[model samples]
Target chain A: MANEVAADANEHGSGGGMPDPMHQFEIKRQVELDVFGIDASFTNSSLFMVIAAILISSFLIFSMRGRALVPGRMQSLAELSYEFIASMVRDNVGAAGQRYFPFIFTLFMFVLFCNMLGMVPYTFTVTSHIIVTFALASFIFLAVTVIAFARHGAGFLQYFVPKGVPALLLPLLVVIELISYLTRPISLSVRLFANMMAGHTMLKVFGSFVVGLGVLGGWAPLAFMVAFTGLEILVAFLQAYVFAILTCIYLHDALHMH
Target chain B: MPQLEIADFAPQLIWLAITFGSLYLVMARIALPRIGMVIEERRDRIASDLDQAEQLKQKTEEAIATYEQALAESRAKAHAIAQETREKISTELEAERMKLDRKLLDQTEAAEARIDAAKDDALSQIKDVAATTTEAIVTSLIGGKLTKRDVSAAVTKALSE
Candidate 1:
């Protein structure tokens, strides 16, 4: 907010110079609360995360509160969300993953909403942050790992050893598998974060070109921005879907040890 | 950027948990089941409606078949009745024709018999007249008292000749 105030003040001085595109991702302190030096403040990121959550809840609850048999537009959207996640879970994990439907659905909707909300001009994207994505990914990883251990006992370790590999190559393959397994959270977190950051940055760059090239020459960049924005929207939905499905696959690996 | 800052992790996680936890609760508790139920209910309703439609169509087809069968039955009955009536009328006509034929035949036989009797009577009368006439002629010419037997034999001979 302080930077925004300064930016607003500077717009008057510089006659509409373009601000840094990455600046939009900055977290502004909304309510400062430092508990034991944790600096656990409610920032803009928290605000948007809450907004996304509330929006998701209300969008679902209110839209389907009537639960019309022939669903209207918003209710149809609600149901679409439900089926999309349900099918994702079922496809990735099969019947055994049904119990995790709520979690997968929640994660999918949460990430989807966060990514889409970031598309707004000044909105903060929570999923764009490594902290948020990593937290989600790590939680999923831990849960899946625990589930694997609980379900398969010591046999879960066999997942790291391929069934058809020669005994001589088994140790090397095992190490590779272990490394890949350990990198799940990192890869999952980075995939979403990097995509969101890169897409937003590209949009910002194109957007700057549109603004910097005046009304006469800005039409090309403007059109490109329009097209790029559409692509980014698709990316947003895709990233969320990717996140959810990967979690399910990880969950399946844990449950079936395959 | 603030996103890379290590200090912000706690706040992000805390709020993520707080909000996402509620979202999950609402989804599992209220939203998902309702949506699932609505979808399931719609699918079942469609299936049942299709079943009902199929049943009704079959019933209609069966009714048509039954009606056609009855029509065919009634048509056959009418044909049989017409055939029976025609045969009865023809047999009655045949009997009447035979009765008329018998009556006409008897009338014709009576006429033929009468004609024959008349013809025979006429011929006998003619022969008697001839004999009498011949005997009278002979008496007139001869003018003598002749025996009756001789007159008779004379007349018979004349006639035989």
Candidate 2:
């Protein structure tokens, strides 16, 4: 019965079949290519990621080339991006964490550019992939954990045992802390991936509806498209913020060892 | 391609390796160093500017203090000179007053001595006239023969003392 519905839906599409909104989440080959023992499939996700990286680097370099005391339009954008990430780090991790400014700034820029790039027509959101986000999150989790141990040595274990808790409730608190600690990467990764995937899928679905409804009746979906487009843009910025903020929190945990 | 469960993990691992390795390299090499250089440069510039400002301020304060001291010294010298001139003028006035008083005292003593001598001479002449008159009246009343020798002898004896 589901197949029937899917087939019926496919019939209405311009193509022989309807493309799954979920299809965008799938990793696939963009070119027939191979490298070494590995299949170098230049997938949509990879393409968009590379584009994001290039755009980030070029934007900063070009804007700062002048390095004017009085910033021009491009320079203001560059400075704003720098200050935004810097402030996030400072607010979360305090002055000591300022040393990690470059790392945090890079993370914010890479994620932000990827998100904004994905919003363009025919672009893939690399951040929407579970693999991508999970890897980024895992790195942060591992790095922060390593830093805590390196800084605190054996005392790192004390982070799990809250200081003021009574002995009776200590075990319970430790369990809760451990569970939360283990779930950090999961929560961080899922937030980015889910929001991006859901928003883009909705957009594709609505976009398809606009085409399917034809010009005269298409105004409804078209209006939804406009509103959803704006919403997606908002989501794009939000996801980057969420990701960067989580990184800062993780860094804070590392620095404070709490 | 048939779906292999192991193949599912392959993409994830590759992406993980690429992301981790690339990010590590970027941070260790390019991004961090550049950022560090920028922040350090800004700090050094601010420090130097503060130092220069401090030096300039000290110099300015020293100049101001020296200027004030010189002005005070000049004012003090002027006051001293005026004070000395006033003292000299007052002493001169005091000396002139004393000199005039001494001259007036000498003239007053001379005038008093002359008047005392004239009074003594006048008293002697009055005694001589009284003696003569008293002899003539005594003789006229008594109706006695009083000779000029006797009268002259008495008048001379009285006048002699």
Candidate 3:
């Protein structure tokens, strides 16, 4: 459905260039009307992300409505997502952090749904873009910083101070702590974005070759396509898991700071 | 091929920020609280049910004990009543046999007195008859012989006495 709709768009009109798989990442100016002199670009990536958000919300809400003791498949899936994040947060962040279970579970489910949504053909993989991943990472970074300050007050600054360090090594330890703190958002974002983009790009390259080779000569490309598809699916789930776990670790740093 | 422009990345980041912020707010404010409430409510309900079940079990055991105790008391009372009634019947039978023995002894004494009186009357009559017979025989025999009357008279007097 996504491909046919995009193909129809291409057939009826010109969007100025041929559709590269990366073309979806390009920001298109959507509303002619500007707000506060800032323009909104509702690109294909943004559109698909919106779709993913709506899909995830509706899926969980509808699945949980009856709240049956004996769960159906969808309810079980929703519950599994909940319990998985709850356990992850508890293990990493400890008992004090259990209060944040709902937030962590939501984060996991949303990212997981969005990641899986991109695997469908012709849909834009928003996490493939640095901007989407960076935004998520920044949110976590800010939230942890806020929680650290809220919980510890002036003591939050102690995160940069090393425990049991020799006076001679204090300078070096502070620098290391500062650098690690600053790099959290960057590493968190890059890990997800790079993995998603690289895997999808590989799949596209092999897929096109399979098509270009046509029937008799397609065997090699077909095999590559199958293996790559499986790998991409694995990467999708791994990226979501990595995103969630990293958030938990960050939360742990905020709560414990040791 | 045209190089990608820097401006292309700007709008993407802006939209990403907006979406991310919106998602965080919605989760923190709305969805999380509702889910937490549901979970807490379920926990409370289960705890209360368990407490009620425990109380009911304890009460049931108490009732069973009370029932068993009452049953034991009833059995003891029945045994005592049976023992008392058996003793009463045995003593009543002993009293009845003693009364019957006394009446039998009195009837045997009255029968022995009547037998004594009848025996005395028969003995007197038999003596008188025996004397008359002997006298006639003796007199007839003795008449042939002189003075046979005197010997017969003396024999009759001795028999009478």
User: Which candidate order results from sorting by lDDT in descending order?
Assistant: 1, 2, 3
Fnat of every candidate, listed in order: 0.86, 0.07, 0.26
What DockQ does model 3 achieve?
0.18
Which lDDT tens digits does candidate 1 get at residues A128-199?
A: 899889989999999999999999999998899899878999989999999999999999999999999999
List candidate 1 segments past 4 Å from native: A1-18, A34-38, B68-72, B124-161
- Return the TM-score for candidate 1, rounded to 2 decimals: 0.86
DockQ-best of 2 and 3: 3
Model 2: residue A237 alpha-carbon error in angstroms: 2.4
What TM-score fits each model? 0.86, 0.68, 0.78
Residue-level lDDT of model 2, residues A58-159, one tens digit each, is 676666666554568987776677678888899999998987777787787778878898898877777877777888899889999998898889898888
How many residue pairs clash per model?
0, 0, 0
Q: What is the TM-score of chain A, computed separately for every candidate? A: 0.93, 0.90, 0.86
* Rank ordering of all candidates by DockQ, starting from the highest: 1, 3, 2
RMSD of candidates 1 onward, in order: 3.5, 7.1, 5.8
Displacement of residue A33 (Cα, Å) in model 3 is 5.6
Q: lDDT of all the models against the reference?
A: 0.88, 0.77, 0.74
